[model samples]
Target: MKKEQQEKSFTMSGEKRSKVYEEEAAYLRNRRSVAGTHTTDRSGIAFSGGGIRSACFSLGILNWLERSGMWKEFDYVSSVSGGGYAVASVLEREFDGEGSGKTRAEMVVDKLRHDDGYLRSKSATLFLLVISASISGLLTFSPIMLLCGQSASLMINIYPRTVDNWASGIFCAASAVISLSTWRMPGMVGKLTLFIAVFFGSIQVAWVTGYLPPNLRVGMGILLILSWLIVLGLLGLGLSHPLIKRIQRASFLGLMANIVLTFAIVLHLVIDGTGKTHTNDVLACLYIVSLGLIFLALLASPNRLNPFLVTYYKSLQTAFGNGRDDAIWRNRAQQGDPIHLINCFVQSPRTREEPVRSRGGENFCISRFFCGSQSLDYFRTATWSSGREKKPVWRHQTIWRLITTSGAAVDVHPTRQSPIVNGLPTMFNIGLCSWVINPSFKRKHRKGGPVFVLNFAAAVGGNSIKQKWIRLSDGGHFENLGLYELVARQCMDIIVVDAGCDPEYRFSDLALAMEKCRDDFGAEIDIPGLFPQRSPGRCHQSKFEGYIRYRGVDKPAKLTYLKLVVTEHHSMRMRLQSSIDPKFPHEPTRNQFSTKAFVDAYYQLGCETAALAFPVTGTVKRAA
Candidate 1:
């Protein structure tokens, strides 16, 4: 019995040992997951949006960091729009801490120098133009033709077979617009008032215009009345009490309206088609397809088709502008070229204070070479676009390369010897770089790499205050650029490179965006609350220097904002123009970047700047 007891004790002790080992292993696994591989040393680098110039500058900074043997310090890099291209370039090169024979900076520069033709290829431009034209045709120009035909059918009864189709199309569009516009109107009275007014107005107009047959007019009126009753009943229920609050909270009101409109239009078309000709059927089909395209164009993101024009016109009444063209007017009304904007600012030579005379009496200045720079005030109050001065609207920044001078471009400080119009850094394109980081926080639906293509315009919901779908423009639209992304990832250290267009080179954008991020995302980040604005004679030492300390509840990240402003002599534009068209004396030199020297210079500069930030390690070679 004593021998048996000894054997049993041994078995029990062995089992206990195994169990303890399993528990310890599980604990380590959980700890590993809770704190990522680099939890203690988590760091991120963000590049702000400044088109191609900012991108090139980011490459330069990356090169310098890599040379300093600190590239490995960064776990992830993020950027907005044009900055996205830079992040992509760096990721694609995948430069290990040590250069892979040729440094990524060198590769990037070399690629740009040799790949200029690809960017400016007729095929690429044609492709963009074709897409633009298709979008225009499907949404705008084509609809005009359809509307004209429908109008004629209503007034002159030319297409008797198609009268009902035209009337139904009109009703569908009107209903959708009304539903979307008034969906958020508080109180049942306001919503009901608008709905009744719109419904009655539409039916009366159709009757007066001969859009409805006299015999079916009564039936149509009764149908519309019943439809309105169902809608009103639903709205009443939605706003009544806590019981129906769940359904209201779901906010499927938009969907409900859409369903009702679709049903009503289809029913009318089907009933009217009982004795209609085949010609009518085809016309009806065409009308339906065209209407669908219109809705799709309006509702879809601008990435697929440039919808700036549509929104611009829609908001013209509220937009601030003189509604007049001027000499200093750049292509503010045209679509911005993200690539060219980047190239022009980073590479172009600074213009002299005196204007160069060009053909047709056009005074060529530096401001004429860039667009979308005038509207980049990080701290400026937001306002709708009205054709007037002092309004911070997106379209104002749309100015194309205007060669003429304007008050907007000039710094009116009395201390200046002359009004400095072109002195401002054009690449300081609002320091606007939108970033979507924190894979965990990304909308569950937006899986995959769609994160890269996301711009400021895509992330926001409809403006609840305006009761209009926010026409999301570029990442610059919101002004809350890249810094927030780093914070969201719980990065312990963040290095930011703001190569945007800033005349004073103040970190206003960085400060404002950070504060805004805190407000919007509950991000715990902090910057100088009373940071001084850019002023002359202040030594401006703060230009390339500033830091924002994270002051959140959780352990904060150390933030560093580096202003990477490239001078004219070192600019890629000047280098490109000198090599490509050095002989132009009588005309303004157009910007281009298709050479090796320019690439070498930019690459070297980037390396040098990064090296300055983190000097190379000699005794120990730290992995990036």
Candidate 2:
């Protein structure tokens, strides 16, 4: 009976996966038909992420495509991070169905030119971020401090200062060190040491603080020692035993708890045992300030604030057009334009075990018809909600919100497990960006809202998929070039725009995408023209035609790669280099507050590079 039930469950899961694939295929077919490109051949253009620089560069490419009448040839536009900025703005304007008597690229460029400081200047938003951090610190740390204070007071009353207290403290510290060191080991030795450390240290603490009779303490200590020996004997068995694994995990957790409790008691005793009210008050204020600073450093650092400022600036009415932000997911794609795939990373919920793959998360795509990923399956975008009953839930998010979520370039990348290692630049503000929604069913009950504690816990815990809520951040955290999704869909002809920061032209983003594509989809991408001989005066080749041979597919698909680099032929490059900064196109991506000249220079560079790569007569060919 149990076997039959297990088989039934497996069959249901397989059916769900099939349904997701079919729905995605149907949506793509409809989009291709709308663009008049519903053929056996599939083509797509990918925009690489590099903040404002990439946005301007992609706009220029789009402008050239519009002028050359090649904009409608492709069926999909895949973008990540800043690359999504330009695409989202253009699509949102088109969805409004209001004619502006200008090309899509021109309208976006004009708006950006007028508001050149859109990415830099947001005093109000920055203030809000700081305030949010302060409040979060108070709410999160206050209870912890109060608990520590009560524990300290209880210890003072119950346990008088004795010589054994010092010994107990020493044992506690040693146990913490041993338990932390166990993270590096996976064998029985690590688990055995952890069990011994936790048990011995805990017994010492109880014996010293319990204030029992000497004979009773001696009896309890001997019993604990015997129990510890028995546990050590059991460790001789294989580590694969379920009971052993659980005990190992429990011992580690207990070790951490013991360390924290000891520190709190010591800190409270030192601060409040002064017996002078004035001194205690001063020390308490200092302690609170220290806590506030720690939270501020983690939550409201400049790196974290920059993404929020960029998102806020782009979401403004003046930036996109003077109209209400009424555009929804279903209307984001127009009839003649290609379907826009705004890629983001869905941070998985952490479990006890560490993740084997990308530590940051998986690739999540948001489009008009569907919103989800391959691992999580697909859901209808029209009726998607947060699913939590804590507050009023919206049926769908606006186009601007979706774009902001996609472009949220926080410091947490897919390679690292902790944000602290990256200087704690994780995005904790839930209002400005980062949307939480049900991954599978549209109406399933999901806990939602801006709970800072829960969000911070999720960020620290790393990414997994076994939780009630998923956090979405910058797609660049997984793949900056935005080509992975297109390759996953098996596009036959792909044009990639490489505008990321690459001063030496290393092509790291492209390399990352290549590695991931080969591993995930068994696709082999080869571009011989990427490496060219350098010339002093003339332009180095930035456009290369490659081919991708997908597994099980007979013929290789054509790939067009376009990169942004300085060339002596472009007049703007010479002019910008001479008058302004030497690094014209390769400026730091963090320079969101670029001057008007810088913005125009990048835009013109994009146009110049595209013109040189593919002349007016050039066209994107459909796959044979």
Candidate 3:
């Protein structure tokens, strides 16, 4: 018994041993990684915002996923606790030998001497990091989106655009160079320094020796990266580690190329002071600049680095089973369905320098895709108008409908009147519009073809300009033939396009229309509120004229409608622009269109003047 006990103790000690003592003197490898850099008090306020943002993002997404019924399969919430703890343990300063960073380093070292194996492993890790970053970036707007089945149109609409893709290429290239140069790779100091110096020094030498010029740097850089990629592939093949070999085969070179161009064009306008240039060029530059950085950041994230990206390369990874329907029937899943809506992504012709608008459209697109897709599965119904027609090219059946700004909901004219309308802008008085029809509702809602999903190309997020646009009503309604039977509508049969006075479509109007539609349509069950509530928390009221005054600072225009009326119970903060990024171009001066003050000038005067005749109810929640 004593001998056995000694043996067991020896084995246990071996199991617990990590490389903690190998090079404990080094601060980076010896100390710890900074993962939860936001939660610590030593962290900056910017970190605080990011931490709060991430938490809100996590909570919001999880809640939506559960509500959408996808939470059952994903198990993201429960798994998050374990995953978070594991990550914390590995990232903390005190944790010994469990870090993947260290393990990956050791693994690399094992094959370093074998050129072919080393090359392949390196390439594999790089490629994996690329895919992970792209996918992660894509998921930011649509976390619950499914990538396969009848709902693939959702993927199409959500995919990044040409310019954005180009930008990603630029961003990835820069990040790769930066990371490679700065990598605190686990190795002898002399060896590490030599590696970085050799690789980086080669580029510098190429430039100084006139082998590469500023104009041709991009081309030269590509060649440099390609050389690395080839070396990795050969190295990986020699080692026969399928994962690294897969990365070599997948080709990060091409993907990064696309992203690099995206970066060049996007940066042309952002920091180039080219807003006065052609719109196409300006737009192109803006996209590449923003998207490039984003992609680069993704490649740099450690969790996504090395050997994990082998998963997405399989285009045929049968994600979920489709019902026994023919391909023809299967593909037309999104046509004119209550749960499916066509969204557009607009961009100029490769180059432009223009002011980009991020707020209005992208918000509408994501909300519709995420919220609309979710409602169909748990709260609404989706029908394939194309399924009935039997063709991919016909009607509202396909997943993505690319309409232009001309298709924008605001232009359609209103033919009727709301008698109560007096001084209100004619835009809001309009009543019904198309796009709200529920044709599939009358028919037994057969489990709608695999959940039609929504995609938010980073374009649509609040970052800058959005190439992806999800069509929604602007100060209008689409109550056609009651909410039940969609009146046997045809794909292009013109669903009686009617408009009223409202020029802008706000949440307040949608909620009202939904409520009235309950009885007007005579449905068996009426959802109490598909829209959010309207109060200080849920609703915001602003006029175009009032907003114009918030922009100027010098002769800061006193907005006719923007004077605040603050009080005790309620403290309102209003500005021409969003309060989050309150500063405007003419902060100290006045552009007559720039923001000057951030005030609520109590609603007393505005409200008293306009009796609460058109009060809407709902909570105004910001998009996560």
User: Could you say which candidate leads in TM-score?
Assistant: 2
Error at 487, model 2, angstroms:
0.3
Worst 10 residues of 2 by lDDT: 8-17
- Residue 537 shift from truth in candidate 1, angstroms: 11
Clashes of 1: 36
The per-prediction CA RMSD against the true structure, in angstroms, equals: 20.9, 9.4, 30.3
| Residue 622 displacement (Å), model 1 | 16
Q: For residues 527-571, what per-residue lDDT tens digits would candidate 2 score against the true structure?
A: 986753354323366688999999999999999999887665666
lDDT of each: 0.38, 0.63, 0.24
Q: What digit string (tens of lDDT, one per residue) describes model 3 on residues 1-624?
A: 987885543111211011221211132221123221111111000000011111122222222322232222210011011111111111111211454333211222122222221012346555655665454444332221111111111111123244443443455456556655655654345434443333333322222223234567566557656765664444234332436434532333332222333333333324235443453464455455545544443333221221331221110011101212122123322211111122222221111222112112211111121212111111111232322233322222211111111122322221121111200111121111112212223223221221101112212111112111122332121221111112111011111111111222233332333343333322222222223333432323321121111112232111111111112222233232235533311122111111112111111222321222112345322222
TM-score list, all predictions: 0.45, 0.73, 0.18
Candidate 1: deviation at residue 200, Å? 5.6
TM for candidate 1 is: 0.45
Among these predictions, the greatest lDDT belongs to 2
